[model samples]
Target: MEAYWRRTAMWYGGVGLLAARVVRNLALPPAYTRLVVREMELMGVRSLGVAMIAAVFTGMVFALQSAANMARFGAEAYVGPVTALAILRELGPVLTAILVGGKVASGITAELGSMKVTEQIDALRALGVNYVKRLIVPRLLAALLVFPLITALADLIGLLGGAAIMFFERRADPWTYWNVTTYWVLPRDFLMGIAKSVVFGVLVTLIGCYNGLETEGGTEGLGRATTATVVHVTMAVIVSDFFLTKLLLALFW
Candidate 1:
């Protein structure tokens, strides 16, 4: 058990160090630029529709649930604040991160792992290319930038979803929702959500790429790394959410 724990810690630590080095030295070479653009297409544009749909449905569900609960206590006026706070601080980034983590991380792991197993990475190395900078850096940059953008979009869509529920489904005056949103929702919530999304983006990219690059033992190993990438990124997202929440509450609330 101790040996297992030690190896696990070292694995994570080594990956963290490698990622830190890569991020610190990030310079957009021409090929890297092309790769980043391609990744943006895959990570951002590809996932937009799913993120929008998920955000809308989640917002609707939150509003309906909150309304039902608040109705019992004659606290329906608080619905707008509730919905806004939930979407801005919690749901938007968290949901968006999950979506991106699954999509981007899995794809990256599979792709890189395949390259590793097929001797493509070896070929790059033999040809005197910087594999980390050429491959990992561009994708990392794309995921980091795109995840936060998606989170912002999700927040807006979620707010709209909640507004629809309040105005159409619950028969509340639209002004009530708008008024409460304008008055009660704090700007810090928006900042916190975006910050959280940025951290999640970093986590997803680093873990996914690390797993892919480290893959061994051929096909089965690639499959294992892909699974591990998703699981690790998801867990990291949840953990980061908790810490960010605590920090925000301490500093802002």
Candidate 2:
């Protein structure tokens, strides 16, 4: 128990320090604009297909189930609003964060871990280049900038999916569905979801980078770090999600 707690404390301290450095060095000279843009393409544009697929399926399932329940209550017309609210408020952000978080986190960890084990990071340090600025900051900033957009895309695609299922399969009115959705889901709900994704992005990037920097044991350690990055980011995203939702609800609502 003592060893475990001690290790946990060390990890917390390390991650906290890494996060602080990232913020402090965020505006370093030269801007690393190209690197950041590259990361955004990798993190956001490359991730579009997966995010859309998840969103569509999510919206479809929720619409089907919500419609079934609402039908029993003679409230089937409200299914659109229910599905919209759920996706905008919770499903879209959380799901996008988790899924894309896993992919991006693992990639960052693997890339950095390989660099670390190969002494490439040390070489950059010897050259006076800030690894945090060059590597961590770009990825972190990219995640922060793109995650909200991804979540918004998820929300939009999800709505369309729900409309498709409802209009075609259930023969429901698409205009009414969209109208009810727009009427029920407020700006605050959308903002709340985007806010959650922002924090989640910070968590994902930092955790991945931290694990990569801490990696040891060469290739074996790289493997472990990548695996740990995925697990840690996923768990962090999920646990923080509850607190974020609670806090955002109080603040936004």
Question: How do the predictions measure up, each by TM-score?
Answer: 0.95, 0.97
lDDT of 2 by residue, 204-226 (tens): 99998999999999999999999
RMSD of 1: 1.5
Which candidate number would show the highest lDDT if scored against the true structure? 2
Model 2: residue 150 alpha-carbon error in angstroms: 1.0
Candidate 2 wrong stretches, greater than 4 Å: none
Residue 111, model 2: Cα distance from true site in angstroms = 0.4
Tens digit of per-residue lDDT, candidate 1, span 5-114: 99899888978897877866586454567888999999999999989999999999999999999999999999999999999999999988987678889999899999
Q: How accurate is candidate 1 locally (lDDT)?
A: 0.89
- The TM-score between candidate 2 and the true structure equals 0.97
Q: All candidates' lDDT scores?
A: 0.89, 0.91
> Per-residue lDDT for 140 in model 2?
88
Lowest summed lDDT window (length 10), candidate 1: 23-32
**Which candidate leads the pack in TM-score?**
2
The collision pairs in model 1 are none
